[model samples]
Target: MSLWKNRNFLLLLGGQGVSEFGSSITYVAMPLVALTVLDASSFEVGVLTAMSSLAFLLISLPAGVVVDRSARKKLMLWSNVGRAALVGVVPLLAALDALEMVHLYVVAFFVGVLTVLFEIAYQSFVPSVVTKDQLVDANGKLSTTQSLSVVLGPPLGGGLVALMGATRVMAVDALSYLVSVVSLLLLPMREEPPAKTAGFSWDAVRRETAEGLSFVFGHPVLRKVVACTATSNFFGAMYFALEMVFFVKELNAGPLLIGLAISAGGAGGVLGGLTARRVSTRVGSARMIWVSVLGLGWTGVLVPLAGPGWGFALIAVGLFGFSLSAVLYNTAQVSYRQAVCPPELLGRVNASVRWVVWGTLPVGALVAGWLATSLGVRETLLVAGAGGWLAGLWVYFSPIRGMRDVPTTEPVTA
Candidate 1:
């Protein structure tokens, strides 16, 4: 039977799809808000983005332990509620003309913390809802929708911004979390109760944190995954911090065109999503990693080379290649992790992996802003593209490059 026929999976997809779209909306609208309404400088905008990403660095370890200990459903539920309230406050403040950079900072940081909880829980929660063998298909489906969200969200947000303004678009983001909460509430399956033996303590946090970290670094496949993902995210952040600025200033793109550029780049993501499993199965998983990250990842450099009008076509062309390969790479890696990692350690492992990979984003974001201030946008993008191209070499040299399939979990290393 197809996994799509499963009711709970569908709910998970629908709810997350809605929320993803909402967040993507913010991706476009947030910078526009900073640039247009608040008159934030490029550096200030980077700071705001950095503040949000700071949570992965600040709390990812503890958050992982917490997700492992708690009911993932409840954690996700409360996390969404918190996010809803935090983000919803923005529009209210905007209406009252009371919104400020400080408010954005506070919201970004706290919401980021909740996001850590939600994402760890979400990644850990998936295996409970499906058989172990179905993981790739499940991840592929989710990734496909995720790519679709990227394809649709920006343009939708851009159109709304054109009509309703960015604050209103943020309000829509808050509403999307509510939709995710509803989906969580309706899930037919429940997260396995956290192992009774694992109790809470500062000692437990430190020990378990080490265990999670050890698993990621100790495992050959996971180690490479971390290296490549971290490098991509770091450089991606440097590029992303300046991307909106690039579109507006360098290409002289309006909001719609900016959305188009991002969407076009991701056009291949949908294709990648649909084919990742098939391609990886046909070739080898390790080869797919190199192909996706190394082969397609470098195309992102084309964004800097683009000009306005017909010349802007380069962004879409580059994005199509980059996005396709990235989605393929991610779906394979995530499925491999979910399939191989021990259940007791899933939350911690996911969090540990995220800690290393996502933690770079803030640093990258801040650096991009600073670089844009001193070096300029195109140069920053050039560096970002080249960095992305080289990000996967660690994988190429590691055992991950030679593996035919994900390996079984190894004994926990001290």
Candidate 2:
């Protein structure tokens, strides 16, 4: 049966679609709120961005273990509820004229922590909901909606910020989370908990965490993919750290143009998602991973080349290419991971991969702040673009470069 006709899959997509829309709004609105409302400096913006992803570094390992042991649906529900409550605080404070940068920072961090929990569980849950043959199609459909939200949300967010205020725009995000919670509640299947084992202890967690790490690093292709993704994320964070600042100060853009510029990238993501299955079929799934990056990611340089008026279009073009390649790469690689790992360890392995790859984001944001302060925004962006493109080289030199397809057999965990 087509995933479109699958009731459970449709429910999952509906919930996630709304959630992604909300997140995309926050993605553009949060920094604008800090920059325009609180009058935060470039360094402060970087810190704010760093705080959002830092939770992945701090707790993703443990989150994987928890997902493996508990009911993924329950974890997802709790995560959505927590994030909704946390985002709601922003609008409440704003209404009272009590909003502050510190408040945003706190909200961003805690929301990030919940996001880590939700995402790890979400990835692990997908395989259970669909057959192995449906993995690529399932991910492509999911990515398409996520990309579409990015395409539409940023422009709407910008308009909302202009018409109302950035703080109030967060209210929409909070409402969206409630929608996701309701969707999860309506799903027909209940996930059974993992079999009981010895009583939980710090020692057990430590061993399990190590086991996950070993499984990822022990696999030759996974380690290279991790390296490539980490490098891209590290530099991608730097590019994004200065992206809005560049639009405002360098290109002299207003809120609407800023939103539109960001949306261009989302447009690219939409194309990537829609084409991922076709690309995988023609290029070979494993080959599609590196091909996407090496062929398209270098266009990221168009951003730094952008100027005022007509030249400013270059930023959109650059963002489009980068996002397109990123979505393509992610779809292929994530499906690859899902295919190769043991079902029992999927949660841990996914978490382990996220831990290493996403860990670079906060560090990159911090570095971007420092680099922007020292080198200026445009120069820092140049560095980010060049470094991010170079990351593809890691995979190009690995065994995946020679393969037509990745091995589907379960890997023997080290």
Best by TM-score: 2
Give each model's whole-structure lDDT: 0.85, 0.91
Please provide TM-scores, in order, for all candidate models, with all chains considered together: 0.96, 0.98
lDDT digits (tens) for residues 1-414 of candidate 1: 588799989999899999988998888988888888898888988898899899998899889899888898899999999999998887888899998988888988999999999999999998888877777778888988888888998988888888999888899999999999999899878655688356678998999888888888888677888898999999988888888888877877888878877787556888888887798788765467776787778788887898878989888888888888789888888888887788888889999999999999999999999888889888988999889879978778887766776543452342
Highest-scoring model, lDDT:
2
Error of 2 at 73 (Å): 0.8
The per-candidate count of clashes, in order, stands at 1, 0
For 274-301, candidate 2 gives per-residue lDDT tens digits of 9988998899889998999999999898
